[model samples]
Target: MAVKTIDDTENYTIEWDEEIGAIVFTWDKYVSGATFREGCEALLDAIKRRDAAKVLTDTRGINAHDAEDQQWMQTEWMPRALDVGLEYSAVVHPDSVISEMDVESILEGMEHSGAEPLVTSDMAEAREWTAEK
Candidate 1:
């Protein structure tokens, strides 16, 4: 399947992976406030356009995100994603301790969201999980 670039910026890249029918978001740096919002919006648009229900997010390069942005992702984006048929999300955790903590915080908030999220340090594992029906 062809890979389609949804949004590519200096800080991150969001893409459509047709092989697994998932939208992939890879962060190259820490993002907050406006940058985070823009990335989320692009991701939402990609999900809708691809009719994707699964997501593979690679956060290994990111240092961390702002608390407010994390909250927005959990409270706002998560529900909106679910409403659009999102059912699963696989996150490849960052190496930095602080970044891992931030990811954990977001995951905690996602506990009650409709989508199921799996956190891991392995990208291949994340892809495998997202590939499951």
Candidate 2:
């Protein structure tokens, strides 16, 4: 299995995990504004180039999202991702209650369209869910 690092920054790391066959987003304690958008664009580029169908987001290290970023994720980023063939998604919930709520809201909005992500507290569970797809 070939694991490729697509994007690595102080805020996050996005990579292709060949074992699970998914693009993984490993976030830091806090990410917002331009950095968050850039990371999302990086993922989108990888998805297009690799023809990826799955994504696993590890939010365990992250805190809350800015309202604007959350809105951009639900409105702009997600649709673009789906258009580029992103199918299944799994998100490992953040430890903080505030961040968990933020992530959940985004997932709930996405449920109405596109791939509804599997949100879990356990990374193993999230990995398994994405790998199965």
lDDT of candidate 2?
0.83
Please give, for residues 1-133, the per-residue lDDT of candidate 1 as tens digits.
6899888999889998877778999987877898888888888888888888888999888767788998998788877888887788888986666766777788775557656888888888888888784
Tens digits of per-residue lDDT, candidate 2, 13-82, equal 8899999999998886576899788877887898898899998988888767888998898888888888
TM of each candidate vs. truth: 0.88, 0.90
What are the C-alpha RMSDs, in order, of all predicted structures? 1.7, 1.6
Give Cα distance to truth, residue 117, candidate 2, Å: 0.9
Question: lDDT (0-100) at residue 117 of candidate 2?
Answer: 77
Residue 122 displacement in candidate 2 (angstroms): 0.3
